[model samples]
Target: MTQQHGKKIMIVTAPANGKRFCGETNYYEQLLTAVANSGGKGYVFPLDKNPMDRKGFYWDAPNRRWVAAFCPIPDIVYNRYPFKIRENKLACKRFFQWLDDQHIPCFNTAFFDKLTIATLLKNDAVLSAHAPLTEQLRSLEQLRRRLKKYPVVFLKDIHGAQGRGIWKVVRKGKSYQLHSQRKVFPSLTFPALSCLLQPVIKQRTLLIQQGIRSLKTADGVYDFRVLMMKEKKHWQCIGTGIRLAAHGGFTTHVKYGGKAASTNAALLRPPQAVVAFIGRHVGRLLDASYPHIREFSMDMVMDRNRQLWIVDINSKPMSFDENIIQQKRIRKLVNIFLKQGV
Candidate 1:
């Protein structure tokens, strides 16, 4: 009932016409190279706007380059298309449905919702200890109640990505202050806080989460991007890299002032075992909904007390910055998809 996947793989960079390819050309090249070296062949293509069944950029392994060549429908589809909105379009949805009709496998692409992920993790007894207390802020009253419990709380977009607009609300005695980006608003009363957040909630959903005092870097707060891949029997950890937030910044997002570093993997050794355990649990959880999900990535942080917390998870993981981690991940991925033959 299913199409037997071959070694030939189709790597989709975007819904249509995105030569940028996740803005990590080097990573793309490496993946293609790995596939080539592994004896399985592959091609890179845009998801739409082109004849997906017949043309793509093939790897010129000998010359160490990509060549414009005619391609056939791949045995497997490895979706690298990262834009959530584009992938949600009617046209894109139809294409994915078509893949389903053809029985061609595209392992993952259910763009994660932060609230759903947090709530699911919070509900799991084994994972609850590592999950921060979070709730959907449907109204100012909800946020006010949360503030009563946690001294500092964070507001994150339910559907947001790359750490955008994650604001902080810190309670100083009876006064509350909202911190957005680098700007810190003056202390406000409960009514004033309600007024400020009313428009935001009206526009989109925001989840208020318990803000733990995390380990700080010289730049700002930092967290580990734990990369994990799904194998047939278990989840394989690719590697971990640290992302340091920009000075006085709220998140460790590279597009913002945050940057990646190899700083102190030793410090994370103890928690990584736990992280791996959680990854396996998450692998099973996601696979249930996504069917045959190949992999996922997690954003984790260590609190000042040296306790690890699970902050986020994404099915469509971006490439890691650390060279070694990226290299290891590519090899593991190639082995997974190319085991069958091009």
Candidate 2:
């Protein structure tokens, strides 16, 4: 559990203030403290700065503020920048390329495409049963065909997150009704599928997925958010929590009025052991395919028939809970950082 002394770890994330890294402030504070306690130095490296220059701001522990300094190429760079910034910016691409050129190890280097992951999982013999029916929405005709087979269908932006740009479509008599999460139009009734979806599909590539009949209580539909982190050479489950969607909400993202609590086995029809096993297997599969990934998050659910399904995979997972950080797994993660130095 020992780390190489004075090994530097730089956490790349979105700017919290105009000057300091504060997006996940509390979690970063705890992580920096954990790194210090483990004989390494942790710094908040902002994404806005030029990676090629090898100079950025670091948190000043004594002054309790950020100070600009000439940062050495970190032993490890943990990329936690928001998806939008990472996806759309030219500088981010250059920064990551710079990291590659420098041979610096970075985990969760980029975001995973929804359709690509789904297709890969569907093709895997062992994991195929756990994957939902997913297809890239290329045209209105494709959506129409899928709608005929499934009662409720979801059209999601391939790059969207936090429940943004997701639509729920339901059949209503001879027409169809669309319900959206973020758009100003709450509900729209369309006479034909093509008429409704042409405008949406024109905007961006969408993923058409058959909605799983979610397990629900009187409160709301619930699912699990399982976090897996690399422990030395192997992956380990660091945290599992139940997320209940807000009433009338289709997604369990916290930004959409969802709430999280410690996992309750009674809440699921299957034994918690089965769920954990599937989670571990999925994590291993993902890590094997994407070697640079040190941690990731999976969104999973159990249907009424007690079947498990993996709804989503996030390469850039959210910050870990303090309890998870304090566990023995953090030491293993730090050790990997010291050894890998990618």
Candidate 3:
């Protein structure tokens, strides 16, 4: 009983299991392992309703990997649902309800939809200064209109992450060229474009956005991942890493081979003001509405005109290769778990 005290932190996960993991059976083991290393207890909880204590998972230090061991009832729950598809399930909502019924505080229970995130930023006075025009994707006419105003337009899945479910469009004369899957499709007539996108629109909720060109720098395109965490009621910046987009890559996600640059030979880096704008100002605004969002990684890019735009905001951001930032983030989270625990 004493061992579990002040250390039990539970992570709510999906039923897809750790089998989906490419390497480790459970990915959250890294977090739990960090918790173990940080003098706190952490475990992964599957999204089912079973009440078995050891059914979840705990970090097994001796084995140097995750093992199914007895996990004591946690002091708090951290929803680390891996996929948007899984997190969107009704089971996730009900699981949160169960945690609520038990009076267990859970953080980061849901995904921030792109449309809502855009609207939130656009409506805020200070954040709006850096916001881009975003609208729901409905018709072919909408695409044409967006292109008229901006040289490029992007159709992003409202709930997509890691650069999946995205389409890039560039305007040329009266026609448009669609870019996706690392290949450029031939130019299409307005009518043909509508026909092509109709199925995609019906399948997923995509947001039409004005695309901002990255600043012309010899140091490759910089897509930044700004990690922020709450220290008491205020937010603190953990680190800003350059997400290295592959040459002509549509997205800068590691899954697509874009990793954080190892060297800082960059022609440009994010200004502290830009970091503050997202970490302090925008972080507070987001927290005010979504109080459950304890931490988030903001994906941002600076344009040629030196304007920064938020491309994505995620509650369960993927791992960064940078050790220092990861260390700071893990320690902060461990402290939060300890402080928030019963």
Candidate 4:
């Protein structure tokens, strides 16, 4: 093990058996493969897996714990851990802090401590034009009042994803109906919405947004998935794809019966100029507001009038499948990290 000049890289992932799927899996594997092809060693470690739990956990490849043990640290760590850390959720935070204490070069810092991704976006001024007005809905009257200003309003769980527990309301004659699953699911389920809202609002974290009419495709509604990666000088756009909802659907999440497709396809018809413009703005705002975060996946929609709206900004976005890997960009990222000694 003494005659090599390769780097040791690791990707942070969710619990091995965690129910949800994150972008880290494919990113780690593909990056590792790229590193190996580039004469470097790559590894992976589940963020929640404590090396101390199992006296000798056997990782076939290099792991974070082992890298910390044998090499004292790694050249770089691709942080993709998504679980929330609350006052009651501080288990793994200490471990990352320990690594920080040792001067480990983590892509993201735990300095904010227990703040959710939404917290970062809550302030409208961060990207005021891109962000919608999100208010804490108190009663049916408040929701009704909001309808006057915003014909379409969104009722979302503070902690929602993949379109679950997200409802859109539109005026229908004298009344309004909630839209999801491409059809109305009984107008408004106040009890259901309230149950989801109360707990978070009690913490003053729940929010309701004024909905924007997103671009629609022949298949259904669609949104842009812009991949932003941090380079030595600045954040660059690696690539972009369109997430199209299944036929007659409101959300483009594959889990909710949505499918992924190329942005250039007819089904996801978007102007190249618009896409490029959005990408540049997203990169600029991220560098200004969250400089500590190296990568993010931004979800945006274009209304009928062609105004762009940012609906989601995830610090950690899902990685593309092997079929769509952009090899040149991956190599550039590796070279940047190696050159900077990150």
Point to the candidate with the largest lDDT: 1
CA shift at 190, candidate 2, in angstroms? 4.5
lDDT of each: 0.75, 0.73, 0.74, 0.59
On TM-score, the stronger of 3 and 4 is 3
Q: Higher-lDDT candidate among 1 and 2?
A: 1
lDDT of 3 by residue, 95-187 (tens): 667678877788886777777888998998888877778889887777787888998888988777778888988888988888885777767
TM-score of each predicted structure versus truth: 0.88, 0.88, 0.90, 0.77
Model 1: how large is the Cα RMSD against the reference? 3.1
Ranking by lDDT: 1, 3, 2, 4
Error of 4 at 56 (Å): 9.8
Which digits, one per residue and each the tens of the lDDT, describe model 1 over residues 273-325? Answer: 77788788877776666665777888888887788888888887887888788
Task: Write down the lDDT that model 1 would get.
Answer: 0.75
TM-score of 2: 0.88
lDDT of 1 at 193: 80
Question: Which pairs in model 3 have colliding backbones?
Answer: none
Which run of 10 residues does model 3 get worst, by summed lDDT? Answer: 17-26
Question: Any runs in candidate 2 off by more than 4 Å, and if so which?
Answer: 1-3, 16-19, 61-64, 84-89, 182-196, 262-266, 320-332, 339-342
Worst 10 contiguous positions by lDDT, candidate 2:
182-191
